[model samples]
Target: MKSPTQIINRELKAKKKCQGNPTKKYFKELIDYYINIKTLNEFCFAFLKIKITAKIAIFYFF
Candidate 1:
């Protein structure tokens, strides 16, 4: 088993190694991806609603 100090030092080193622009760019990309997915979902939902409404209209009319 590792000592507590060894674990702490390792964690600190990892934090220092990762601190900078890479993290920011990753988050920005993540947010952009989320936004794109949300837009696509909304578009699909709208399309489905229109399609269902059309089907209902045709059923009643025919």
Candidate 2:
């Protein structure tokens, strides 16, 4: 079975490959969004916190 670290590494690599922007631009934009954010309400609404939590739970189980 793949380790948790292996799964996380795979996910990161996939994200890096699929993400459209250059790495530098992506990080800059992410940093700006985090620094300027007042609340995670919008973020949570977009992502749906419960769904992500369930995903994490499933990952742990696997």
Candidate 3:
């Protein structure tokens, strides 16, 4: 198995390579790697609910 040090070194090398602006493809790849369809949908729904609730609260107070 790879040692912890080896894994860290590999990640550090990748970090250095990412110092420049990332391309659109790389950005999308990173997003896809980190988030799945379900999670993205949950985030969007939660955001919309918050905005709608805030608008209602403002309307009631005004």
After superposing candidate 3, which stretches have Cα over 4 Å from the reference? 1-38
**Per-residue alpha-carbon lDDT of model 1 for 9-39, expressed as tens digits?**
7435544655574344433443343344435
Q: How far in Å is the alpha carbon of 45 misplaced in model 1?
A: 0.4
lDDT of 3 by residue, 1-62 (tens): 33446534743554466656334333343344334434665556545644564576468656
For candidate 2, write residues 13-33 as lDDT tens digits.
Answer: 644754785344434543444
User: TM-scores, in order shown?
Assistant: 0.36, 0.35, 0.37
Each model's total of backbone clashes:
0, 0, 0
Model 2: number of backbone collisions: 0
Task: Give residue 42's error in model 1 in angstroms.
Answer: 0.6
Clashing pairs in 2: none
